[model samples]
Target: MAGHRNIGSAQSQSFSKAERLNSKKLMDELFNKGSSFVLYPFRVYWMKHEQPVPSKVQVLISVPKKNFPLAVDRNRIKRLMREAYRKNKFLIIDSMNGNEKNLAVAFLFTGKNLSPQNLTPNPSLKQRGMATQKKSSVKNLPQYKLVEEKMIEALNQLSKNSLK
Candidate 1:
């Protein structure tokens, strides 16, 4: 190799730091004062406030134990929610426009056990070419799509609210 230099240490990426909200007052304001939009799986609440310095976004993740009785199931859902947010949050960031305002976002898992009545066996159909067409075994997740769409809608609403 003519030139192979290690640049792992030299390279740095700017990542957004999550400012978690743990105060009762903040939580109350978030629920009371903020406007919320439900995208099935996630309900996003946001409000803009003045700050001496630029405020970073705060986030909270929650899973209802009643819905998911097992700790493992709750944890798994939480992990997936976090990953989805992490991957798609950049869209929200881009919408912020460098405002010196704080943001609070929460992802609540609303998934419950599928009803037995809703369960149907996958039936295989023969294709014209060769392989048989197999029905997808994956459960439909409308909430996930709702989350993404509602995020965009919320961002738009937030921007409009900021203008007023």
Candidate 2:
């Protein structure tokens, strides 16, 4: 069973510690000097480093405490962001691999908590004259699909920018 395991598959999708941007000095430099662009839910900041590094790209994911007051909410958003990046990071990484410069990137969550707008009431409920109370719904939570889509787009955009 062990011998049959697909090592390439696991390694391709792995988000190792080396990929995380954790240095305070580097973080500050990235935020202060990096160029940025808004892609709806995320504001991406990226800078190319002249120095050589083992990892082609380092990423930092942030969910603002002000937008997500609860620790659980912030953590969930961050998790989603990280997962999205982990899955689609090859869009940027593969492009950067041959380049001499290393990249530092940060993905900041800019959108508010997602909640479905009840613009039109259900016809059946309206006809029955039942009150539509706003209860906590799964629709209000962040979605992986949306996050992954945005992450893919952001990585593509970053790769394009890096080429120039």
Candidate 3:
């Protein structure tokens, strides 16, 4: 049974408390000294951990109240971000496993409200007194598939950066 492995225990795709960045001090340091890059809907901040951490990678997901005024909307966005991260975190984990460095990352939601109704009218159209019509083909990307795709891309980018 040397080669046999339990599929269920092989990879835990769970977002555990241990993998959450919760320390105010560490968070302050990460914000103050971390390198950041914008990946469309997310502004990612990451720093190599100075202290030994239980997990190889820890993450914080933030949805700004300014962008999403409603609590429900913010919560939903956070949930989607969390789910996407939970499923794809192995991208970072596997990349970092060989290295001694532990990583702390923050994912800030930078996109405007995803709801079509909340979309702001074009300033030129507003100034010209032209009606702004919503396009039927343009749908909100609150769906899991779209969010997951972005998450995967972000993680892949971060992994590449971490290698440097």
Choose the strongest candidate by lDDT.
Answer: 3
Q: List, residue by residue over 75-94, the lDDT tens digit for candidate 1.
A: 65566565555545545555
**lDDT string, candidate 2, 51-126, tens digits:** 5555879999998877766676678779989999987887787788688889999999988755454122236645
List model 3 lDDT by residue over 36-128, tens digit each.
999878999999875877788999999887776657667877999999999888888888888888899999989864555434334654566
Q: What is the lDDT of candidate 1?
A: 0.53
Model 1 poorest 10 in a row by lDDT: 133-142
Candidate 3 lDDT (Cα, 0 to 1): 0.81
State residue 133's C-alpha deviation in candidate 3, in Å. 18
Worst 10 residues of 2 by lDDT: 131-140
lDDT accuracy of residue 156 in candidate 2: 89
**TM-score against native, each model:** 0.56, 0.78, 0.78
lDDT over C-alpha atoms for residue 26 of model 3: 87
In lDDT terms, how accurate is model 2? 0.79
Report every candidate's CA lDDT. 0.53, 0.79, 0.81
